[model samples]
Target: MGVWGFLKTQFVVHLLIGFVFVISGLIINFLQLCTLPLWGANKQLYRRINCRLSYSLWSQLVMLLEWWSGTQCTLFTDQETVDHFGKEHVIIILNHNFEIDFLCGWTMCERFGVLGSSKVLAKKELLMVPLIGWTWYFLEIVFCKRKWEEDRDTVIQGLQNLRDYPEYMWFLLYCEGTRFTETKHKISMEVADKKGLARLKYHLLPRTRGFTTAVQCLRGTVSAVYDVTLNFRENKNPSLLGILYGKKYEADMCVRRFPLEEIPLDEKEAADWLHKLYQEKDALQERYFQEGTFPGPQILPPPPAMDSPKLPILGHPPPLTSNLVCNWYLRQRLPPLLILSFLGFMWTASFAVRRLIGVTEIERGSSYGNSEVKKRD
Candidate 1:
């Protein structure tokens, strides 16, 4: 590696980056908190301001993943879906596997113009996290305790609150409800066996209550449900550490859009639909492992006997749209502030409380919503 490349990997440099990320995030969170007073007076205006604030904070992480780390995010869908990406409100069903998957999703959201306004059904505990979690408060994030009985009412109402949101939004749902792990996978398949649902090789059983409820609450407002399957190229599972050190990794996401009307309103049918979707997701993962791409024919060299014709390569997949994302992020203003404000004692802006494991991304190895987490419910 050259001088610049070597610098990117240094711990001191990473600490500098982390310092900027943490401090700027807190400043943005403070701004988001300031918007709370506008809630009753002008709710729409409050939401708009909070969205931008949220973007300011979240996009810092996206910056690390896109520019600072130079990660490539390749999307596989048709032009039609691409055209509609930032145009309409969508509920994104993202598979939970890699630790940085949400960062990748946010990178896409940043490119599509919805990064600030993006939403997710996060667990209740994240609300206490300093920057990201606190920002979620004003962003109107839906939080659940994972108890069906206790969460049903509150989660539905939270979803209903977004019916008239001012900006086009993308709400992400991790239906598996947690990160995938070996022990959880075994238990999830056992639950699937009992429920007679199809066993999934690469995912935990998707918990459907949250997904169906979100659809029911946001029916008229949301235009489509984006079924997204994410995997890293070469199956190299990625981490925030890789991003912190500016390591380059390629991510492939297969997105299939389903019109909102197609999802049945009846709760039972919707649950079944989510289950069926997971089955198809399983097949997609299987295909990705078998072939290096999603459910599509591979581009290959011609047979020796008939070498005249060959398939053309798609635009250099080397680092497709993320460069565009990085460029757009370049246009933003706060990142320059991140550079100038790096000299302060950053411990006050520290991500962890120093007493416990703090922040969601930091706790990727912890079983946040797994079966053990279920016992708390």
Candidate 2:
């Protein structure tokens, strides 16, 4: 193996990278906490700030997939569809088959210039996770307990909060709710049998509550539903750890955009719509297994390049200064220097507080002792 390849396999190198990620992520989370008070003053500005903060953490993983691991993500859609990607709000219904499926979705988000502000319908437990989860809380990403009775209101309210959001966002919904495993898939198919639904070979039965709720809540705010199907070449299964190990993989994504207006307004009808969509997604996956490609013609050339220019939308905003500054700082400075500074500041401040408090308590205890002794005398 080459020197760089040998180095990539080193456990210490991966640990160092993860250490950097955690420290930098904590700093960004701290910065996000500072924005909480700003929400009442200027909600849009607060949202904008958070978008950039989220990018700082999320882009690290994206870089791991795109640059470090050299994963190729090809979008199989027409030119016309590509133009509208980053301009409007979208609800992305993606297949959750691989461990790194979310990363592939982020890859598309990065391409469309929405990586910073992308949201997901995630499990509630993730909200407690240190970096990524804490950041999602600020971004207003919806979380559910997988219970329709409780999650219905929480999901709707969360979606409603994004009505006046300033920047464009792609809200991802992994309707399958969990990563695919053969045992889980079999259990899901058994549930499908009970429901009299069609069996899906490549996917588990999608939970319609999340999908229908999102569509119902954000009917006017979101423009289209991007039915995204993802497949990895060579490696049928890809894990996040594998990406960290610099294992190269090719990801193929087929996106079909449907306008929100076309979807039925009634919740039950909408649920049925999602079921049909998943069926189509299953068919698409079957085709991939057979032909080694998706149904549509490829928009970009083979082995997609990371630097390709994104499709231009009709009313897309001109490049903003904030985005440029945020990208530059995150890419150039945040990892090493800022991590050390933040950690140093935190350690120093904590030590000083503890010492001051300890001294104060000791002094007070001494005074109490003296007073008791004098009274006894």
After TM-score superposition, what is the CA distance of residue 149 in candidate 1 from its true location, in Å?
Answer: 1.2
Native-to-model Cα distance after best TM-score fit, residue 152 in candidate 1, in Å:
1.4
lDDT of 2 by residue, 127-198 (tens): 875666788999988888877888878888888998888888899998887766666677778779999999
lDDT of 1 by residue, 215-236 (tens): 9999999999999999998989
What TM-score does each of the candidates earn? 0.83, 0.80
Cα error, residue 165 of model 1, in Å, equals: 0.2
Best by TM-score: 1
